[model samples]
Target: MLWKVFMHHSSMIFLGLCSGSGVFYSLACLKTGSCYFIEWELISINSCCVSMTLILDWMSLMFLGFVSFISSMVLYYSGEYMSGDENMNRFMYLVLGFVMSMWFLIISPNLISILLGWDGLGLVSYALVIYYQNEKSSAAGMLTALSNRIGDVAILIGISMMFIYGGWNFLFYVGDMKDSINKEILTGLVVLAAMTKSAQIPFSAWLPAAMAAPTPVSALVHSSTLVTAGVYLLIRFSPALESTISQSILLLLSGLTMFMAGLGANFEYDLKKIIALSTLSQLGVMVSILALGFSDLAFFHLLSHALFKALLFMCAGTIIHSVKEFQDIRAMGSLIYQMPLVGIFMNLANLALCGAPFLAGFYSKDMILEVAFMSSINFISFMLYFLATGLTVCYTLRLIYYSLSGDFNLGSLFNVGGEAKIMVNPMFGLGLGAIFGGAFLSWIIFPQPYMICMSMGFKTLALSVSILGGLTGYLLNMGSVNYSLNSLYFHKMTVFSGSMWFMPFLSTFGVSKLFLQSGMKYQGIGDMGWSEYYGGQGIYYMISSWSSKLQILQDSSLKVYMLSFLLWLMVLFFLVL
Candidate 1:
């Protein structure tokens, strides 16, 4: 009956095929270097032509391997997680479609081909976000799609401009174009596109809102495919942005995003949202580094962040599933005692996120902070970087203290226990990657020598942000005086931070509320009153009046016509006399 209801074998087989292709292609890239080919010719009217292309290089190859591997693990994990769902087949198919789109995105270098993947991500992710078919899911999905549509439009504009270069293959021109007005335009468009996809600053409301989807989708979308697409595009196109105004804007926006996400995560209580905020923060780090002319480092951090963030999401899914409907930290406490394995994995991920010692996050995050410091940036960027680092540790420690070790406030009736093999197995695979992914990728990805020279001030601050934020987070949460409410006494600040500085408001109702009210006012004055009365009612009344007058004239047509003619003749004779 289960087999009839859900097609597991086919899904598993697809996953295996992807995973095998990824591993094989990654190895092949190491030996053969970058490869590109036109998959098919779509259109060739006159001199313009569009073709599907697959580009394989060390960069695409390795990222594809990682994405495919994670998707496989996630698919495996979902088998047990979604076993009870009524539409398991639908969910699986959506995920498969999502993965296929991601694959097309990974291998493409042309602007037109990339659109196929980029738009697919936005559309498929919307479907996945609304998979639950609830009000919350529907709202989140719309926000996700609309926000992404901004990037989609940006790419479309960029594609139109590509006619200047006589090719739609952006990968060729992005790195090779010399300084010119047209090149700068291309660079600006690329940056705009990247910012939206990566959820940077103004476009950030969608990432956290997207937590409405199932956890596995979050793990995949947030960690590897959707969000990282922007970062990868930037990394590939970093050369176009070098020494341009676009790069400076990127630095500023990324720094702000880092600060906002870090602050929001510290204030957030929802389990999934906190992790989602962390992903946003890490994306900022990636973008910031890329803006500073460290594409390799950015790519490195991207990989490391993906490994641990995925694991972290999976662990969060485990917690949510075990506890049923409760996701608030206040409702969850002393979870380590009931489910030690999941707890261990969760803490491990949190530690890695905070860049503890040698975990996957540490390798890339440490290098990123160091490189950021060495660069001569404005004071604002400087503060945002270090403060964001501190804020990250602050919230992660808060997470552990509140959820892992605090009092068990979730009522006694709910039974919390270990997860089944189907759930736990995928976690272990990713956990192994989380633990060693950073160290391994650091060596593998950066074969060439990467160096940074920083003064003592930068180094000291870099080290201190983590230590101080960690200690303060732990003590603040642990102290008996610091209970949930009325403890901090800074109500305004808490409200600001907790409400994501009203970003969700600013992104959603904040922007629309004023316009919507203005629309209503215009409707009342223009459409309902003047336009309706004048255009519709007034026109009708004029037509009716004319019709009545004409009818009267028609009824007395013979008499009226003779009287009018006689009156006109008399007037003419008087004028002549």
Candidate 2:
């Protein structure tokens, strides 16, 4: 009966679950006294605890507060966002599942629990991605699942290594096992996993592919759930990452990813894909900052990015809905007049994303650059930093320009107006947060001394450089002559080369085709080949082949089945031993 009711009214059930669970979480946080003992639970001989260190600490509190607040707002927004859609209930269930999984992830005390929540979130996200049940959505879902599976395998291997070399008890605190684990090997594995999860370099393709998901899913994933998981892992295990070569690799990969994604966003014509790429770039920046061992700064940036990115994605959804499901920015012109509320919120969010002073992104992003400068005096780091900053400016400006800046071109279009109250309400809430949340949280998160360390003159210089880059991009869009050729080439070259079209033919075609052919060749060598050879022709051939195989198998089944089961058990026992 419960299952039937839930299936029938999944949306209401999910919303109720979210609200109830959130209340429980808040109560647990408030009642729990210490970082390690909060929400203590015992399962058989194993004990588990929720880490409240971040919750009690100022920095973690700010992020937690923002996560909770934004989650609530998005839920409210979803009430209307998916209104009247056939799968609204299913979408709500997935959203609730994602939020709960993220909550668990943030408070996870041990690596095991973290992995649980991590994979749980991935599972929910896969469902959300394919919610529309279209060919594109299905493909995107498969890509996301495959990419996350690769990352999961790496994480599992790393965990196994840690348990083997380090003590089992050390799983609760990665910092404790840092000295025991082989730094080089463990770091390499962890970095591989993190890079895959964060969509760095080659793994970055999955993020853009995920744009086929609903707008709300995109907003949630980009803002605070999926992409942020990698950074969250790094921040949680900062002590271990900092001591290993992983930190340096993270810096290199993140810097490259930021620059590449930023460039890609600049050239992207799809509105959602642009935001998706922008999320990748922004996540890269966060990862880079965390790689520098500035946990507070990274968390700060995470908070800010979540607010503005969510607002931006929601606004994009609103615009698409307003124009009757059109997402091509090239097709969209000045929508500001049609959807004034969306335009205002989107513009504010864009300003914050561009790192305008006093906004959320500005303070956090500036702090990241400051930490990078302080940590590295190398010319390469400086060059990478400069390139990433410039790309950030160009892409952000491009997003603003192509969508909101042009003349009102209703190009063969019809009705346009403000979004549903559900969508606009969330946008309004996120815009307010983007505008002032960073400033409010800065004091608590940064404190006095840390703020002083981050407020150095060189940090100011970096901010100026980033701002100048943004201004230059903005001016050039407006047909200014003062743009530097060096900057132009840097922006264009990076953007052009980062595209899927620029992928090596060997990578896209030769290797993929080779793999497919190898699989077919292997099937031909096996008894499975008989079915493949006959199945495509007609039902008669398929039935004949199947009947022959069934008869042959049945003739030997008893002995074969017994032997196979014994062999499998022996192998399993051997492995356990």
Candidate 3:
């Protein structure tokens, strides 16, 4: 029993090791700046030595530390949350594997070695997503896996193209690569890979659906580590990608994704999925800022967002698990009365997410918007940026009203409970971080403050949007209570917003249905029809029929053979003449 107890907390032990590594490496990085490289020569490839390169820059070390800290807290919480499962050991191992993969990804600068971590994250996450082994989990796992495969393939293609640089190491030649057609292709491919991983725009359908995973998985992977991988990759490579057409495309798509996800979250009711969409929205913001050429700002936001978003997911998971697994907002109300911690942490996480001043999100999110206002960006991106910022506050308040502050609406069987130390302990660490992480990262990332030479009106734009959006969200949520307005009156609008503008449909059955029908038509008309008949089988049949006649003539008798030969010779002679 004693040994079993130790094994039960094995996840936390691994976290300790990682935490130590992060501390040692972070201090080392501070002393060395960004010049630390751990290169191990692997087997030579075509006379060029292929080596594994691990970069111990402040970025990698700090991110690894953050990842480790979050994972540690999550694992501590998982002890009670997953205590009953017979496969609890498997869950622990998978989560640790995910952390290991993420660390590998963080340290490696070489694309080849990074793939080891990249693919490992993809694989382990798939396993974690489908850990529950139900229909929903299966389908969600497939969507997440297949959506990410495009990025993996793009990276492989980029690797093949990297031979043009005469090396597999892209970190060395990132900014030095000349802008040419080949470079453009390489740039586009890398950005596409990042967008796919980051859940930007068209590739975003997988993030919300990925909430089919367990709540712990949501807190660990979707909210923090895995989804942010793409943004981090882009930030690392931004020097090479800035001012290119690829970044331009990212600018447009990320803006759209930011707006789309915020709108979707406002209308969503599923607690975990709402948080999932929020993660996607934040990802869009990071990518947008990255494309705008403030990658350090983007990286700062990434770290800050990870802190709060993971906490948000943990709170969401607590709520969902506490209420007998009822995750729908319509099914929960006045939860603060019974579960004060959930409500408090939920509100704090949401506040941080809304970019409340002095909180983590404010430091980075505010900086991003102020920079955008200062930059020479187009009107559409500008509008999208501010609108999405407002929408973030809107959805967060709407979530508060539905779940935390409203009158009790849950079923009689529901019990608002999070009493276990295992479940509640993690929220404390994350809660503190959610409140301070953004500010901490800003000071570290930007030792020198930004000098924005903009009008006060432009400077206050982000705060104004946040405030107004919060008030509007409060009014909109409470309006139904005051006047008892029927949602059916705005049925079309609600449906559009709630369904994420039919993005899920458009990404799923919309695309699947169209492909299925198109495939049938192609198969019937082309593969099974004229092409097959005329290209292969039809020619064979035609030649076979002719050959039977020729064989009969040739083998029938000596006279027939002689006649055939004579005709052939005559035809040949005539052609020659």
Candidate 4:
């Protein structure tokens, strides 16, 4: 009934519940200094039923606070931003569903309930992404859904592996199966899933695509909820992944990803794409920190990243909406005169993102870098870390300078001025949070023992180097070079390769031709093989053929009906299994 009431009056009810819950949770945290206090009781549901145990800890409380805080802000912002949209009702439903799933995910004591919440959140995010129902929106939604599903399947398999070899009880299973399961296999699968969900490396293509969704959806799902799920998984299963080899792989993969994505963002023209790549880089940093055995650093970065990234995205949204243009950055210039407050907020958020001193990102990111430095003196890892930090500074400053510093050119269009009150208000609130939230939190949230902590001098030195790199890039922009070391090398490579023609030659003729032409004998086999092997045409053929067959199968009434019933039965069986 309460849910029904919320459904009926979603904006007011959700706002009230989230606000009240956040206040309650914060007060509880203050009073107890802990988030979770577990009480276990056995209850009989049926003659043969699985026994369940409830467990709560600081981790659960931390996540609960995160969900409550972000959800409340999103809801408050959305109430005004989405006021009269036709899909507002549906959006509300999805928002509530997302919040509930996050709640369930955080509080669930066992893997099963957590998986349920995980899948639920994934589904809700997909629905919300397509709420706009445009071609780009749907495409982005499908891409995100598909990528997450791949991760979900990996997680399911890992969980099943745990059940089979590690035992069915999650907490007790860890100690029992320490020697039984293959650490390599478990770690490999978990890392794969984590990378995909967190938008790390190769699987990261989906997140920037997801920028086609509404700004609120981007802020909530991409910035706060879905991206953080993978981090939560790593922290939750830290014990299981404590082996030296697993930690090494995690560190290397995350470090490389951070460097690559940050580099990518430095050259990106789209505003949202820049932010999207930054999200990937930030997640990599968090993962790298976790791999270094600094769980506290990961958690701290998670909190700080959530606040600043969401604020940055919201500020970008305001800019895009007011200008009535998708962000190319090149098309934007000197809006500070017209949108002074928005410009100021944007600069503040960007400064935090660049790890400016005394900001939220600086505190958390410096801790991670310090841990990385102390973990190993390996030159390779150190260089990778340095490069990632430098790239972070370059891209963040690129965003700030390109969008806010150039001469005021409205382009072909006239002045659009600032955004509506609904949008501006959220920007203001998030901006304030981005600037001051970290200092306030440093005092209030950091344990008493950690309260007097200061940034390491070495870390400060590293940050100064990063600042110099960014400044050099900014100064270069004043010249007519129009290219950096990265772009120059890329241009030379393209020229040497005859502008992407050599790509096919190298991939197909040089390598794939050797495979296809040497052994195959069937008629049309060479064509199919070459297409699949060299030209990359086979994938298209396969997909088109499979889709056609699927369409035909769906059109068969008896087959369709039987398949539907079978699917229903399977779902029921799983539910009761």
Candidate 5:
């Protein structure tokens, strides 16, 4: 126990220090306008010069700094959040292993090395997701793992394809393969891999299901480590993905994903799942922007969103912890009265999510929208973008209303105020980031401002949708105990929207339903019916009856044995006659 506590504190402090150093070095790299590419030549095969390569650029360094910082805070938060678990040591090690994988992923420009990190992430995430050892967690872990495996397979295929180019260092060849047919195929594979990892479109069901993991794990995975890996990879590979066909496809899928997630969040009641949906929504925003040919903007939002989203998850964790581990928003209300500090931070994070000016989300999210609006995107893409933005605010306000303002719902006996100092302290660090991390990153990432040439109407469109969405969301959710259930009234639509367009069913139950049914059928007829009747039970019954007759004959008296012999002789005489 003491060692577990030490692991948490020691890792937190060490990561915190590393975060600072990474940021300092990143700034130095930016100032010098230079990057360090460290290459260690491994064994040469056919003079191709296979080497372990690291890209120590400002971009990689800065991202490392942010990831390390969020990870440090998450570790400190977990020290309190996971303190009661018997296997806290395993939890600590798993989280650290996750961080290490992200590190390998960030620095490696070689596809071969990237696979090491990529597979590590998928495996460790499965471990973390199933940490509770419950049926739900196991199912969720399976979904998460299998979904990410698609990306892993895509990466493996890409590696195999890259071998034709003499090496797996895709960074060296992405630019040169622009017009090559193989390059297009490789880019498609990379996009597919990114889509699966980032949980876009048809592959999105796992993101929300993954909420079954512990809250701290949710914070780390959703914010910095797992989901963002895909976006980060795209940012690194942006130069190669500039084809119009790829961009258009990415835009469409990501837009739909953004809209779907935001719509789903409004209907969701589980606090953690709602946050998970929000993460999905934001991931959509990142990928959509990346598809629009602004990888830097995508990268910018990635960092800024990480800050507040991590904070958001932490706040949600504190609430879940306090409410006797019940995650339903319907079970929690007027928490502001009991846990004022948490309420403040939670509301702060929510508002940031709404892109209420100047917060971390605002700086990145608002800009992304403006840039999208300004771009030459099709009508469908444009409408999806704005609709999704509106839905984001809709859910955010709805969450605040249900969880913060309404009546106090906890029982009178429950004492659900005053969070642990450890939990609250980590929130403070993230809270500061949620407030100003955007502006800070904006200045650092973009030395020059993005020039906007839009009219006044276009400028206010984002704010307009946000306000409209919030009002609509709040009013729709406002009701007394006698309020009619919207879900019951509009069952079909509710089920469709609330279930992410039946994606979970399709991804999990739908995909496996046939096989599961077959197994049940086989169990009933093959194993329990025919196989048992004829194979095991039939033979047993036959043997048992025969042995009983044999025992009876063996135990028979002399008269009975003599009568049986006479009866057999009489039958033989009759047959002879």
Candidate 6:
């Protein structure tokens, strides 16, 4: 047990050191505008080079820093959160493996090489999701794995298509091949893969479902390692997508994703799932901006969001851990009075999520929205952007009301207090990041501030919607014990909106219902009915009956032998005469 604790602490320290080194290197690279590529040639054929390449640039290094830092905190927190489990060592190893997979992904610019990390993420996440070994966790793991498998398939096809270009290193030739049919197909595949990874639109269900994982895993997965991978990949491929049809499609889907996630989050009651949905919404924000030709902005938001979201999950973990694993918000209230530290940090993360003032989310999210407003986008994209932003605030405040402000609903006998030092320490580390990580990232990523020239209404639009959303969220939830249910009046519309526009149904049961039904039919008719009658069982029964009759005849031979011989001799004599 002591060694296990030591293991987590040691891993945390190591990752923290690596995080510092990566951040420093990233800043140096940014300052000097320098990038290093280390490549080892595997083979060359017809002027196409195949090799393992590592890209050391500001973007990759910065991401590495954020991922490592968050991972370190998560590991430290896990030491206490999962300390009682028998497989603590295995859990620690799995988390390390997950981080290593992200590391491979961050450094590699080669399309072929990137799959090592891409597929690694899917496999390792599946392992982590099912770590609890419950039926729910198993189902969630399958859904997560299968959903990501679509992206894996897309990446594989993309690699095959890139083969035609005589090299798998897309960085070397993507710009040169711009607007060509092959380039479009390759970029389209890449976009499709990113959409699935980032949980955009059609692929959004898995993100919430993946909350069956341990909270520390949730912190890492939702914040950095898994969900952001798609966004990161697109950032790398942004050059190919600029002004193309792929960009337009990605913009539409990512916008819808942002709106859908925010809307769903407002109705969701699960603590971790709400955070997971928020992660999905933020992913939408990042990708939508990427679709708008601001890869740097997307990357910047990705890093900043990672910091606060990790902190948010850790705080949620502390709360859930304190309250004996009750995830339902209806079962929780007035936690702020009991768990003051957790409530403070959780609300801090939530406010940052809402883009309040100068917090981490304010710098990137506010900039992304402002840039979206200034961009030459269609009216639909424009409304989706602002509406989604409003919904973000709506859900965040609703969360605070239910989990932090109301009367404690769990009765007086429950054990709920934030006394875990291991957990609190990580939240503090991330709290600092949540407060200033955005400004720090913005300064490093964009040395020149963006110039905004908009009308008064457009300028105040973000704040206006945010205030309205917060009011709606808070006032709407304020009700007596027997308050009338408004959602029942508009049941169908409420259900549609709350259920992510039936995407979970479409992605899960809608897609699998036919095949599942077919399998059931096959099992009934072939295995239980016709096949049993005519196949192996039927033949066995027939053979057994024949053998039984033959045995009986052999056993009765002594009595009948004399009579049979007499009859045979008479027949032979008659024939001779």
Using lDDT as the measure, the top candidate is 5
lDDT of 2 by residue, 210-302 (tens): 888888788888898788887777776677676676778777878778877776776677999888888888888888878777876887788
**C-alpha lDDT of all candidate models, in order:** 0.86, 0.71, 0.84, 0.70, 0.90, 0.90
Any runs in candidate 4 off by more than 4 Å, and if so which?
1-56, 164-169, 175-177, 443-445, 448-457, 480-489, 492-577
Q: How many steric clashes between backbone atoms does each model show? A: 0, 0, 1, 0, 0, 0
What is the per-residue lDDT of model 5 for residues 257-276, given as tens digits with 9 covering 90 to 100? Answer: 99999999988999999999
Of the two candidates 1 and 2, the one with more favorable TM-score, higher being better, is 1
How close to the true structure is residue 80 of candidate 5, measured as C-alpha lDDT? Answer: 90
lDDT of 6 by residue, 1-577 (tens): 8898899999999999999999999889988999999999998877878788899998888889889999999999999999999999999999999999999999999998898899999999999999889999998899999999999999999988988878887787767775778878888899989988889878888889899999999999999999999999998888888768899989999899889889888878899989998898899899999999999899889888999999999988888887778999888899998899999999999999999989999999888999999999999999999899899998898899888997668766798884799889999989999898888878877888899999999888999999999998888888632378878888898899889899878877987887788888899999988999899999999999999977877886875778778999999999999
TM-score for each model:
0.90, 0.79, 0.89, 0.77, 0.89, 0.89
- Residue 334 of candidate 5: its Cα lDDT? 90
Residue pairs with backbone atoms closer than 3 Å in model 6 (clashes) = none
Tens digits of per-residue lDDT, candidate 3, 212-257, equal: 8878888887655899888888887888896689988999999999
Q: Show the colliding residue pairs in model 1.
A: none
Candidate 4: worst-modelled 10 consecutive residues by lDDT: 496-505
Which residue pairs overlap in candidate 5's backbone? Answer: none
Better of 2 and 4 by lDDT: 2
Candidate 6, run of 10 with poorest lDDT:
478-487
Q: Which has the higher lDDT value, candidate number 2 or candidate number 6? A: 6
* Root-mean-square deviation of every model: 3.3, 10.8, 4.2, 13.5, 7.4, 5.6
* Candidate 3 TM-score, true structure as reference: 0.89
- How well does model 4 score by local distance difference test? 0.70
lDDT of 3: 0.84
Give the Å shift of residue 53 in candidate 2.
Answer: 14
How many residue pairs in model 1 have overlapping backbones? 0
The regions of model 6 sitting more than 4 angstroms off are 45-47, 480-482, 516-577
